[model samples]
Target chain A: MKFLAEINVMPQKEILDPQGKAVKIGLQNLGINQVSDARIGKHIQLQLEAGSEAEANQIVTDACKKLLANIIMEEFEFKLIQL
Target chain B: MKFLAEINVMPQKEILDPQGKAVKIGLQNLGINQVSDARIGKHIQLQLEAGSEAEANQIVTDACKKLLANIIMEEFEFKLIQL
Candidate 1:
């Protein structure tokens, strides 16, 4: 089966996100003061072929651990759907 | 009321994603050949104050148009949840 994985890699909450902070400031500067905070991260979409759903899950998890996310500073989660 | 918006800004399909291509090559180098393609984009979370859901939606849509997305090179979508 073919599957698509939508992965989100986000900085750990305890870590400071300079990019997000900058975005918040930018928004405020644009006169959008209602925004209290912003957090920025990566959205990765993967297209892969797998024999089954379980196999697809395993592949995506390994990809996240090995390449997609920096476990030390960022965490990742993904939803896999058959395509 | 307060709302949180989970936004994704992605390169338009016609555009090339060098970052994602790099990731795909890296994954293949690591022996993960099942992945056929990859695309990387931005994930942003915004925490904001609004009077109602409709108002919050308008605020977020405006943010996307004015700043969050380039509109020319990329496209964006977001989900807003009351907090």
Candidate 2:
């Protein structure tokens, strides 16, 4: 079975995102005024082959902990689609 | 028109990615040895409303510069789909 995983990695809410803040300020300069909040983050797509959905979930979990996200300063969430 | 953009942001070739290196070593430990290289990065999906393909492209470009990517250490590429 093949699975497609969409993962989002973002700085913990308590942690300051200087990059995001900088971008938000820049957006204000660009005259797009409706935006009030800007949070910057990363999105990851993973394609994995597994025997079952359970196995695929395990793989994605491992990938997230060990590779895709920084556990110290970041938090991640994912949704899996069987393809 | 609506467009779906898949954006990949990666470290510049000149930059050293300690995270990616750690992942490569960890994968080798998992007994799945076919993997020789690991590069860690981000994927972003954008849902945009536009009047035409050309306008959509411009919006994407602006978004990339202003929000979606870090031009200093990262690079991005996107594909647009009409919906």
Candidate 3:
């Protein structure tokens, strides 16, 4: 079976996103007064071959833990679908 | 009223994602052979004040068009929620 993992890795709420803050300042300078806070993160999609759904999900989970995300600074969530 | 916009900007399918390609190679080297293709993108969350839902949505759309995404290489989609 082939599967796709749609992953979202977001900075922890307590963490300061400097890039986002910089963009926020830019927006404010543009007179977008309504804008308050902006947070930026990463979106990733992975395609893989697996023997079963469980196996595919497990692989994705392992990937997130080891390489895809930094657990202390960012958190990851994913949805798996057969492709 | 306060609103939140959750936005995702992804590399177009026709675009080659070099970063994703690099990550895929690394994953393969780690023996994660099942991994075939990987695509990376951005996720953004914005907070704003608006008079109405329609206005909030419009503001988010404009932001996406002007600052949040590069239209030639990426595409964006967003969801708006009242806060």
User: Residues A34-74, candidate 3, lDDT per residue (tens digit)?
Assistant: 88999999999999999999999999999888888999999
The DockQ for candidate 3, computed on C-alphas, is: 0.79
Residue A10 lDDT, candidate 1, scale 0-100: 96
Better of 2 and 3 by TM-score: 3
- The top-ranked prediction according to DockQ is 1
TM-score of chain B of 3: 0.90
Candidate with maximal TM-score: 1
Q: Listing every candidate in turn, what is its Cα RMSD in Å to the true structure after a full C-alpha superposition?
A: 0.8, 5.7, 1.4
Task: Candidate 3: give the clashing pairs.
Answer: none
Q: Tell me each candidate's TM-score.
A: 0.97, 0.58, 0.93
lDDT of 3 by residue, B1-83 (tens): 99999899999999999999987988887778899899999999999999999999888888878888899999999999888
iRMSD (Å) of candidate 3?
1.2
When 1 and 3 are scored with lDDT, the better candidate is: 1
User: By DockQ, highest first, what's the ranking?
Assistant: 1, 3, 2
Tally clashes: model 1.
0
Q: Among all windows of ten consecutive residues in candidate 2 chain A, which has the lowest summed lDDT?
A: A31-40
Output the lDDT of residue A44, model 2: 59
In model 1, which regions exceed 4 Å deviation? none
Segments of candidate 2 deviating more than 4 angstroms = B1-83
Between prediction 1 and prediction 2, which has the larger lDDT? 1
User: Could you give the candidate ranking by TM-score, starting with the highest?
Assistant: 1, 3, 2
